[model samples]
Target: MVNSSALSGNDTESRETLYQSKFVYIAGIAEMIVVILLILCFCIFVCFNALILNVYFTTPHVHEHARYVLFVHMLITDILYLIASISLFLVAIYAVYIPMPICYPMLNLAALTFRITACNLAIMALERYVAICYPLQYFQFCNAHRANTSIILMWVVGAVPNVADFFAMQSTVEQDFFSRNVICDLSLLAVNPLQNTIRTLTFISTFTLVALTIVFTYIKVMQVAKKAGSGTSSASKAGRTVMMHALQLLLCMTAFISTVSETYLRDSPVMLLITNFLVFTCLPRFLSPVIYGVRDEVFHKYIRTFCLFNL
Candidate 1:
């Protein structure tokens, strides 16, 4: 009876070991696939943004307009965000946690880029509203100089919360070499009560205001479009473009929620967290060039000419 029991215990242990190995193998494959996808996204973002920047700069008509000015700034922010995402991906691939000295700044910059992108989208929506609803006032309201000033102000406002986050991380979080790399994870760092409160309030208030403004502006624009019978087709096209921007904003907001939640949900599956992160980081960036640049008639003409000449 004792010999039989010993043999059964040995068999159970062997099965457990085999199961662990198999799980690890599957996880390794998943990570590899994710890494490859991230690399592809990085390439696409860089190439498409570069093309857009080139066309906008080379074409006087496109660059001189206030709307394109805002679009250019949006592209810049997307590039910055992509850089941060690439950095995070590298850390993940290496499986080594970077020290606080490097991690804090990286996370802060990512936050800044995020804030700027949100501001840019809101500005774009406002520009579209004015153009569609109040065509005469559009010129007075959204001049090139004014657009430049707005972008400068956006950078200033975006930096404030991130600067606070940097200080908060410095004060509350100690350098821990043993900790796993949580690259670009602002919530992972230790933050004091005051800093946490400020961060939360700032994030919620800014996003809420921006979102409400976008929604209201777009609704008004659509109403105006509906009333303009002869111009309905052009107005409808512009509405679709605005809708694309709205979808991008929605994706970004969802990404923010997923990122924050993933930090605290320790029991959540790893694959799900990775999928959410990838979708949030890559999808919006990918869509920006497509929705804003490729869809533009001028950009399409330039791209086709360039391609034909090259061929």
Candidate 2:
């Protein structure tokens, strides 16, 4: 009886081990697949943005002083965002393929790129706000030199948090776990309350500023349309375009907000899928093109050309 009982216990242990092995294998494969898909989608977006910019810049009629400058600004920001997405895709791949104790600097590069791109998005929003709300003053407000300075300043400001994150990382001891491949989260760092407070405040400020900009632009646009006498029809068309762009920006903002909110909820399989889908898969790949393509004259022209040629 004792021998039979011992054999049964051994069989249970073996089964548990086999089950865990299978689980890990499945998880790793899924992570790899997702990362590959993300990289491919990001490349596609980069190509589309590049093509649009090229057409806008190369074409004579579209290269007016104001339109040209706006196109250039859009191109710069889109490139930054695309580069940041590539960093994220690479990091996701590393998290799956590599073991713990990753090359710290590379992770820092990814974080820096992402931070800068976030700032760039906010600045881009502000640019659109200026164009829509103060169209008469836009050429004066965002001249070539001023626009360059603003973009440069945004890069510097974005880097400050990344530098703080790097030093914070050195102070904390890194850990290894079996489930996810080589996770490196700054949230796991043992940081001071002040650091946490600053980070939280920064995020709140950014979110608030973007929300205000969008709202103010929309309101100003409506008011301008109401006051215009003979120009009401033209103003209405411009307002519609601005509104469409704002709506797309709002969608991106909402996705990020949803992801943040989901983090507070207890982690479950369903919640994980939903949050990841919004932040990683859906928002980046789909929304950007739909919004930009609709508003972008160059993109529309090229798309029309392509369709005509194909047909």
| Structural similarity to truth (TM-score) of each candidate | 0.83, 0.67
The superposed Cα distance between candidate 1 and the true structure at residue 166, in angstroms, equals 4.3
Q: Lowest lDDT 10-mer window, candidate 1?
A: 177-186
Instruction: After superposing candidate 1 on the true structure, give the runs of residues whose Cα lies further than 4 Å from its correct spot.
Output: 1-12, 89-95, 166-184, 231-234, 304-311
In model 2, which regions exceed 4 Å deviation? Answer: 1-33, 60-138, 163-183, 188-190, 229-232, 254-282
TM-score of 2: 0.67
Superposed by TM-score, candidate 1 places the C-alpha of residue 110 at a distance from the truth, in angstroms, of 0.9
CA-lDDT, candidates in order: 0.76, 0.57
Model 1 TM-score on a 0 to 1 scale: 0.83
Candidate 1 lDDT: 0.76
At residue 145, give the lDDT of candidate 1. 90
lDDT for position 85 in model 1: 63
Clash pairs, model 2 backbone: none
lDDT of 2 by residue, 1-311 (tens): 99999999999999999999998888777766665665566566676666667776787766554434544564555455445444543444245454334534444454444444444445555565576567799878756566667767876776687677656544554444323344444443434555576566666676666557656665766676777754555556556655655555555455455445546643544334443644653455355664667466667878778668976
